[model samples]
Target: MTQPSQSNNNRMVIKLVAIVIGMFGFGFALVPLYDVFCDITGINGKTNPYAATYDVNTDVDTSREITVEFITRNQSGMVWDFEARTKRITVHPGELNTVEFYVKNPTAKDIVGQAIPSVSPGTAALYLNKTECFCFEQQPLQAGEEALMPMQFYVDPQLPEDIKVFTLSYTLYDVTGTSSVAMNRG
Candidate 1:
């Protein structure tokens, strides 16, 4: 037979094991739970927010036709189409890459609005060489048409040095659409 002190010790051990199991369960359930929270709040930058802090620039590199794409907001009633010379490009820091941005209307009818470009995860503007494009300004494109856009950029030779590659992504959004503060084209 076990002494009372031994029985008490055994009970404590069992309780500790149960607590550990509960902690693991909580840990396993947290990832998906956090995702849902981010989805709703856009704290993850997956959707647009009520007030976004970014820059807007509209300029074309008359010589280079760099590619740009329009990624619409979630189930919101909007769409995007992009036209550029290239989608995948590589260049050394401080080297200029002429990027052309073209905004093509997706709707059959003319839609007048602005295009907000954002760098996903959490970063400020599109940086190239000596230029910082913080999402540029509001653009007004005609319906069922295309507009030429440009971003003259060069990699920052001092981009952490250890960083060899980075994809300059453009995520197009409409002011009058769902928020995709987290979902970026990164």
Candidate 2:
């Protein structure tokens, strides 16, 4: 009887160990799986960070108008004032539009900042094409300096008719320390 009980305990322990290892492996695989899923379904609002080319001959969908809303924020501990100059705009798909963002370094020291953008209703991300965007590069501003950054973009005419409104939000992060350290080392 004693031997049988010991064997049962060992088997249970082995099964539990295997379960944990399997769970750990699955955790490691989640990121890649999520990326693939997003790529297929376009549900995570991930936009191409690189510039996109626009054809001049593309037909403009003048019959339909879409509303785009812009929002901006500073990351925690970042001491810069950042905002979109225009809060909202109505535009026809396939027509080029430009928007300006204002940024100011109120601190006494120079700082480098980067802006990350995301679009709501994730499905609209693939349809939003940016030809030029300040978010593509890091911005360096001197103390008490202010600057206007521009973004040129258009909505693909193929965007789904259901997605008539979308929000574009940007969060600015202060990369001063990392940038300065890299510059000094190089």
Candidate 3:
């Protein structure tokens, strides 16, 4: 009787340990899951990834002008100089515009960086489309090397009339150590 009871207790302990491990795994899984939810709903100002299949033939709406402001930031411990060349620009809806950002690797060793973008007044995210954006890929800069990153985008003509000003911001994160995992994770 004593042997059977001990075996049952051991089995229970193993089951509890497995449950705890499973719960911990679920917690880590939530990070990506939350990102997907925010991206789809635009609840957190997360900009949608550029879509290659999007139609670009829409007519430019010249009657109204929307001011787009550019903002750049470097994540903590990032040793690169990054800034937008153009502070802001006014454009007609549906017209393609190009802007440039300058980035220099000031450190002695090569580094890789990834840019994550967000649009203020989250509602504007749905109408802002990018045709060509450096944020779409990881940027690798050699020591003391500098490069100009260009982004081509357009404000959809259907943008809500109430939003006359929209801000597009990018936060560059250093991913030198975890480049492979961070590249696709963002």
Give the alpha-carbon lDDT of every model: 0.50, 0.92, 0.88
Judging by lDDT, tell me the better candidate of 1 and 2.
Answer: 2
Q: In candidate 1, how many clashes are counted?
A: 27
Sorted by TM-score, highest first, which candidate order results?
Answer: 2, 3, 1
Residue 109 local lDDT, model 3? 85
lDDT of 3 by residue, 68-119 (tens): 9999999999989999999999999989889999999998888899999999
State the lDDT of candidate 2 residue by residue for 113-169, as single tens digits.
989999999999999999999988888888888899999999999999999999999
RMSD of each: 11.0, 2.8, 5.2
Candidate 3 lDDT for residue 71: 97
- Model 2 lDDT-worst window of ten: 177-186
Off by over 4 Å in 2: 1-4, 180-186
- TM-score of each predicted structure versus truth: 0.45, 0.88, 0.78
How far out, in Å, is residue 175 in model 3?
0.6
Name the best candidate (by lDDT): 2
Alpha-carbon error at 42 in model 2, in Å?
1.2
